[model samples]
Target chain A: MVLPSFSNPGAGPADAVVAASPTAPLDAFLDNQPQTFYESIYRSEAACLCILRLLPPVCRQIVLHVLWSHQTLKSADLKAFCGMDERLAPDAAEEVIRPARDRHIFLSLNHKGNKFQWPLSDTFKRGLRNALTGLGTSNSFGAPYARGPRDEVPTAEALTDYGEDTWESILKYMVSSGLTNGYRGGRPRNSVLLLLYQSGLMADPYDRSGHNPKLEALTITSKGFQFLLEDRQTQLWQILMYYLAGKQARGENAADILSLFFSLGCMQLGQDYSASESFPHMENVLDDLEQYGFVYRTEMGRERGQFFPTHLSTTLCSGESGASRSQSADDKRFLILETNYKIYAYTSNDLEIAILNLFVNIRIRYPNLVVGRLDRRHVKAAMDKGIAAGQIISYLNSHAHPQMYNHPPPILHPSVTDQLHLWDKERNRLGAQESVMFEFFSRELFDETRDEAERNAGLHLALPAKKLLFVDPNVREAIKDFIKDKQVQLRGGI
Target chain B: MSYHDPYQVKASNGTLITCDSAAKQILIHLDAQRDGPQKFIIRDVDDTHVLIKSIYVDMVRTSLQEELEKNTYDQDPAL
Candidate 1:
């Protein structure tokens, strides 16, 4: 509270950054949060874990180093820590402090000589320290089952397999609508499925029951297609954001719900975490977790149940366990993209087939495999649906079979990558635009204006012999202004 | 007039559908689970003004899947 300078709370940056940072999916949480919201979050041990997990490397180092010293560091010190000089103030602020500062993650104080001091909240500092050391008495982290047997605990590997199956069911659920007879098995937990519809992930077809709408029917959206291809971490956060938003709309405390998620994330997989001591909302949290396979609940008689953290539970924490689950999927690369524009994907996974269909024209589906081609019409169809060409190429590159990566630098075949990009660029070449067409009797004025404006290249088209010009509509206003000024100059001369 | 959004265009034989040109949102025909047989995304102008396309969750999966099955056949290479 030295200077109380961390004031200009940033809902604007939060909202814009969250939705706008489509590349950084984790930034979605930072969206639409006011300073007070962040303050309340920082005060809780569980919520602080949520924020601390997403801090970029440099910001993390600074927070940890600052929190440990129990002293505020000046903005200049932060700048220096980022290896930036005083002259590079803007870059330093943007690269080092802006995200945390914008989110009001750091408390800023005005010290002597106009320097600004930044520190972590005491509650946040204590919370993170306790999480790292497992030292605090706060029950934010759920405890183990009472009188639980040591012999029956599930192993991490078993939890991971179950995590993959159930979690992937949700993904498969999206594409099922696209596949003939693809929808199968019970859908994801009712809430998660509803969240999909509610979040506009997968949509239901048209309904007009007049005050009673249909919720059973569902289909994937273009955004849902994009979600399928996103890195696992981004996909998880996207669901959480939508789910939490829905919960909050129902009048629940969002920060507490988030803290519960983060606390569960930080726990050990396969361990039985107790309920009564921590997580007063234990029943609700477990019910939600069961859907996502975050925890397995067991009840003995009338007493409240004990919960176990599945490997999926660690999806929110560091990528170690998450990485293990991902490696299994990534281990045997399913896709093979050839220079001849042919695609051979080895997998019975319907979700992969549906995604491949986004940019590839499938030729045949055999047992355990499918063959396809990256054709012009297919690519354009994807583009028309708002899926970008670059996304297609990268998806191919990441899933390329191991043999394909044998070349130096280990990437997709250069010719295939080149052709994919070339096709994208070629198809986008011809575009129609609205323009202001001009015709004049005076050749001199027309020639002069055309010379000056057409310098923008490809933007202005002229039929010189006919004394006509077509100016890009965007530049029409600017050209009008220029003409008015020219008329003023001519009048002055007269 | 804003052409009453999802404004329909007539085909030569007299069915109202959105033809290729000047169409923003794709007009898809669907057999709605709740509303019975109908065209998706686009509905009768008389329907509620609140029918939002974004939040509309059902898709014409059955018909679309039929069309996709045809596509799967066409894509088969000469063998």
Candidate 2:
């Protein structure tokens, strides 16, 4: 299940073709896994999404720094990589690496003495490299448009709007199906439906709710819950990757498709890429991709032919961090909430309003911006929808008003942040939960075992579990200890 | 975005393979097609060092050209 970056099997530039060695099989690692009593908490989708959203750059930074590096890095060396302090170094690496590890994105190496040697998982590193730098012919980037077609090149704005509209339509479709009180109708393509189905997002679409009856009218499953929590950027990549992986699964020649997709990212926005150059089957794939706002093609005056990648397509090569490059892009901004709780957003775009409408109540709409306030009712309303305080704060921080950019701290008002969290506390409260291990035969064994568990899980004692000789309660801690002990014993350890 | 046909431009010696205009920043391509280890030099507009691996020149050029074309066309409405 190591996703090879090649997109296609056995194809691409000579240097780009990395043969899989199949040296260490995964089953060997999983063979002696412990029961659910000691599973990693971050192993769940919800946790992965929250962590990714909270710290995106950290994820990218960690993965990129270690792509071709060591199996485990010294705690000090890890700190150096991110320029963080000793305290944050170990845990940050754990939080980022654990998710990647769970997703098979990397393999963790055991610590030696005071250091850890962290190496990029062979398959994942290769895939990451290929994805970051268009290496092979699978050119998952995108293909150049055909030279002949005159019509079909879509404008950048068109592509952006199209992507937004198509995506929103899907959301609307999901919402309107009486699943969320019959919102309205907006349908995404069958491909998206197939993708969701494949990702376990929409299982057995044939349910009585007619959730996926037309494939377009779908319901937001628990998977959708997980999906919504991910940053907008990740959601796009997730869907795109889902499609790419799905095509490969269905026996289609994924090389051309992938290469074509990558090529789409590298492609110029308004110019026509020669479609004739595409794999014959890709002609159909383009239309579907268009619905997803992946590309936009328009016909010119009937003779000169071709289509161009929209911002979506071009940004692909730019990497999945998606236009975070254009952090300066003016249009990227949205809500502007003040200490007075007055919110002023620059666009009345339904999507922008809808997103803002999540946390603040819109008083009315001005032509350019929507004026609103983060009221108690709205914040409470939002909490019911599962948008947590942390999520709201981060979302606001990422899209902080340009004016707010000049403030002393410059992210958001502390008052608003505290209030939002208060709103969250009002609805849902969190207390750290842990399990206790009782009555270890001896104190030495208890001490050694607890230390071992902490070391393996990359976690520490939250609090000594009550009456427990060895207090190992963190999900990761227990699992890590279980795996490490099992492995050591199997190898005839003293 | 309207892309200029790559065929429209001639590869002049020492010409940076940028878009049609002088203002368009030329992306560097380190051609490995030369004998032994191919050598090349490229400076960013700010004269910052931009590493160009000798092995990936043609790929860099083609991909950059593709990228620039896409961006330019994305900017152009008449495409």
Candidate 3:
């Protein structure tokens, strides 16, 4: 059986880690990483996290089974392991496993018997398993060991806003650091700057003149560019992990940090609890976490009191799928688009506007509203910058105009969406280049094949032009069948 | 068609007048009356064949049928 690595200060060298079970299979597998214990738990928490993050439960279960076994299991084996009563196994293999392998989380191989063998990547497996099972450290999820006053918790709304604010501050901090004197015209705390430097997201550019001591400027790196494009939830996790890695480097107890982060995810959002009481080692990290907006404190009470978690804190370690920070109501969009290319937004948030401005060419901005046109150049530029039309459309779809949601239409502005696609087509131009041609000696054969093609597939056959038959892109496969079937029928009847 | 006697009509001196039996039947069928203002038909049929034939044209068949039924009820108290 696998057991946790224990560190005893007086037993031997302080830096040495001692595993309880040397013979366990996982022992050799555990590398001397900065946060091995946390990584294990994080890996274990992977499936549960994925589940909570709103990934389909089927994928989560499959991931769990795959991550558990060291060997690559076949699709049939997965189906059996997940219990054969389900129908999603085949789809999970195709959609989840294949995509996960592409994402570098799973490794896929084709065996000799025409079967696929799948296994979770080592880091992903260990991290996910450790997280799900809460192995290694006791502090992975949260500690409800200490009691607190029942009435001290904040309301859900308060917690949500608090989370957004804190998370926004971290983002603002990053962006500001790239700007003049960074955002707030003041240097961030040394630890914050160090963490930023360690994450390699931004750099402090030094001047050539030795006399200019305070003339340092910050420049965002390429990684920062990609990092900023990710939604707030992902950015939050990245920053937190970055900070955690920094702490681990400082020889601070890594297990405690892991437990705290995982614990934060499991903590109640509104309730205030003493950090010193529950996690004594976390006292040093509390100020930083507060700056991250995970905790809030009130001084109006009898005790000099502890802070409570925000929704951001609670969701910091949320898994990838369902429990995504994006899925929450607070983060959902309230804008809809029309076919006419007229844009309407229903929010007054400046951050959202700033984000939208990264793509859309705004025509006008008003109080609580902004109107924009999705021009060709704008879309092309966004595409060039690694954003897809589908992502843009999905973003709009997800945050459809509140009024549009109240009075939904079959399609969100067919004209505007079509125009967007038309622009893409105009820029590419290869879409209209292809035409299909077929040769048949007999007119009777031609007519019969055409009828068959029309019946079997709802192909939009263009009116007869030349020797070519133009059909809708989706039903082209029917053409080959039609030709073969007609030849067979003619041969048989003769 | 055996005649009993030659009938003659008198203006000054009194004389017996005779009319055809078919013409008399038609006149009797055409000149009918109702007992009250509330009743509908202005004519009645004396012959059973003529009455049955004219039943389709009777405008007051509903009230007449009610009156007939009331007369039948009067005759039988059990109804």
Candidate 4:
């Protein structure tokens, strides 16, 4: 059986890029679904299009080739098409065919008088063809709402601002929940709060359950710290994955939710989609998604409303890096780090300030700039709260001011980065091991046991002068047997 | 010579501490204090090494940091 290329030793740099890319989690999530789930979801054109977009370029080429051809192609044909010979066939199979097959996009069959031929899954092929040619029922992609003359259509800029504000509020809540008394400002919806706790990103210090969990009682976990360091797209997907997993655990149908996400991914940003006509019975899910900033919905008084897919949903399967999506032009390079461990941020975004405050000691704040210093005490406190030194360093490096980039590579000052790393290393000075300490009465017995432990590669420490030996706990029984054998030898000799 | 049941074996989940001889001496001193019900050092292996209880590793590290901080010089300006 072929394994995913990411897990293989000889996987190329392209595979490594895909593995580190944001789409990797979505790809892995789809690959982990049961065959039956694929059979059902692949029937939708939107799901097929989203999944196709998520595949590696090589896999996409193979799928497109197989989709057009009626004949089953052998591995040799596939390798030749992908510009590889027999020697590289194994790599192609491992990298391309394995993942596609795992997702049920391609099926490897034993054809008559031919070794394993590849064919696209029938349902996936039909759905993808219809999606590309716009031939099938167009309901897979949400129906565009016909706006009335009196309806006020929101501009793209307004929609983007709305989505960002709603999203940033959730992040602010997570950050402030870690503060001493928590922020007294607006909190995200209770469903989001519950999802944060349920996803293990936040915990109640008092472990109280049932009904609304107090915002101050919640504390961000280590995973939450790591999540905060991630790009906005990754952060969004992480929450959605946790939500889907939670739904699955509660015995709810997650396939419907998955399909909805894929349908949203195929949607156009700022285009209004009719809720009643497009999603039918998924109004509650749509409302919940609106709360998470996936979509912006007009108020529904007595009739059905329309929802506009935000940038978050439109780029869900596009695999665009979060850096491009999250960074605004004005604040793209807002941070300036000095050799003396000082940081000057050129924006007034509260979320950025809160994130910087995770590891930096904020000294002063101005209208458009904030000055902070990275010191041992504050950094160590952040580390104590489970923020890694690497995350802090990367955050600084990624946000370095354009002036800093004017110099050569190593954008952040090397001294500052080195000092941060050293501070992190300081916490790992001691190493722990569970072992058995053997105190021998006779020098001969100690020597015998120490040698035995050494042969087994279980010796932790040995003091020949003091007749003491420390061996791994796992090898204690073997050491005892060796001692018994040595005692028998000594008795027989006497 | 009689071996007398060969050897006595004791097992524990321990943290192997390796530091300078002076730091080890400080650790030994700290372990000797009866400030808490539990001591830090499990056994002194050598001049520069000690086996410590894993549970007290953080406490031992903090105390060691505090002891070492007295000799270090700070050059950062007051904020």
How many collisions per candidate? Answer: 11, 64, 43, 0
Please give, for every candidate in the order listed, the TM-score of chain B alone compared with the true chain B: 0.26, 0.32, 0.24, 0.76
lDDT of 2 by residue, B1-79 (tens): 1243211111111212222222123443323334554444322312222223334445555554455445431112221
Using DockQ as the measure, which candidate wins?
4
| Docking quality (DockQ) for each candidate | 0.02, 0.01, 0.00, 0.37
Candidate 1: segments with Cα more than 4 A from true spot: A1-23, A79-83, A86-95, A150-152, A208-213, A298-303, A319-332, A348-350, A357-371, A376-386, A418-494, B1-76
Q: Candidate 4 — which residues are off by over 4 angstroms? A: A1-19, A87-92, A109-111, A208-216, A322-324, A433-435, A438-494, B1-26, B32-39, B46-49, B71-73
Residue A51 local lDDT, model 1: 71
C-alpha-based local distance difference test score of model 4: 0.76
Best model number under lDDT: 4
Model 3 complex DockQ against the native:
0.00
Angstrom error at residue A42, model 2: 33
| Of candidates 4 and 2, the better by DockQ | 4
Candidate 1: residue A84 lDDT (0-100): 73
lDDT, candidate 4, A190-274, per-residue tens: 8888889888788887765535556556778887887887766677777888888887898877778888888998888878988
| CAPRI tier of model 1 | incorrect
lDDT, candidate 1, A1-494, per-residue tens: 11212232122232233233222544555657777777676655766675765666677777777877856777777777777777755434655766677667676645676666766666677777887777777677666667545536667777776777777888987767655577677677667877787787777666554232355677777777767776565676677778778888989888777777777777878677676665775577567767776666544411556667776666576634236344475654888877778899998876678778878889899988899888777876776555655567667766778877776753666666555554554333322233455554546656766776777552345656756555665676676666557645644565
Query: What is the Cα-based lDDT of residue A382 in candidate 3?
Result: 59
